[model samples]
Target: MKKILLLSDTHSFIDEKILKFVKQADEVWHAGDIGNLEVTDTLKKLKPLRAVFGNIDGADARSEFPLDAKFEVEKVTVWMTHIGGYPNKYYKRIRDKIKLNPPKIFISGHSHILKVQYDKKLNLLHLNPGAAGNHGFHKVRTMLRFELDNSEIKNMEIIELDKRG
Candidate 1:
């Protein structure tokens, strides 16, 4: 089984509670809003991290960091993005970006909402870990855990660190 820790919209800095979970995960994926390079550095100290650039990362159109990524883990194809190519928003450019490369598991952030979707059309798993850091968009603090084994998603966990108030 592949144990993975998924976090999103940190905005910079990370949750201390998240640190405990990171040690138990084989890999970590951050959806976006890293805020600064320091966040990445901190995450790396815990475990190998895979992440993407969020809208707040900066306005550099052609920055070295990619907005999308495809990775293979435990024989499962996972896709990573900040806002997600297939989002609720309406933007032709964004739509086009996602269409360029389809993946089995799609990860994204922006809304600060903890969500998980199963898309039959593309046979994909959409996961949003919500915001691990106190970015202040939502009233709750959330994060996710994914369990994959033999190319199948065995289970998932949505962890609430604090209630929104």
Candidate 2:
């Protein structure tokens, strides 16, 4: 079983509250809009990090991470990107790709709205952990924690930080 901590749209901000959860997770996944490399470097130092670069990210962040990441973890296939829309509203570019080969779990960020949905047509789970930083229009900061055990994604927990303003 692997404890997974998922967050996105940090926009270069990192706080003690976020770090506390990083320390507890077995691995950390950042969907995108990381803003700077330092934010990821810190999380990478704490635990393994799987990330993608977002629209707001600069060259440095993009150099460190890819625009899209597809891989398998604990017997579960995951496809992650920064601006990937959810379900029927998926971004055009990724829509075809998803239809061709859908992953068990799809993750993305940018809207700063927390969403977790199941797409029956594609038979996958979509997750957007919202904005963990204070830089966006999001009123509240949030993150997600869950366990991946033998291909099962379970024990989900939503961690919310203080008001972004």
Candidate 3:
């Protein structure tokens, strides 16, 4: 069993609250909009991190992370991207790719909207952790935590940071 801490759209902001959770999780998965390497580098120091580069990310981030991240964890396949749409309203490019090959879990971030839904057509779980940074229109910043045990994804929790600017 592996505890996973999933976050996105940090936008270069990192604080003690976020780090507290990081220390508790077995791994960290960043969806995107990282803003700069500082955010990720710090997380890496604490635990293993899986990440993708977002639209706002500059050359440094792009050079370090991929546009799309597809991998498996404890018998679960996960497909993650910075701009991947949710459910039926997925982005054209991501939708096209998913139609051909869908993962058990699909994660993305950009809209700064927190969504956790099941996509019936694709038979997958869609998770958007929203913006954990204070830079966006999001009223409340958030993050997600869950356990990947064998093939089961369970014990999910949401972490809400302070209000955004």
What C-alpha lDDT do the candidate models reach, one value each? 0.77, 0.94, 0.93
Query: Which candidate number has the best lDDT?
Result: 2
Error of 2 at 73 (Å): 0.7
Off by over 4 Å in 2: none
Can you rank all candidates by TM-score, best first?
Answer: 2, 3, 1
lDDT value, residue 90 of candidate 1: 21
How many angstroms is residue 72 displaced in model 1 relative to the true structure, after the best TM-score fit? 1.0
Q: For each candidate in turn, give its C-alpha RMSD to the true structure in angstroms.
A: 2.8, 0.7, 0.7
- Candidate 1 vs candidate 2: which has greater lDDT? 2
Cα lDDT, model 1, residue 112: 90
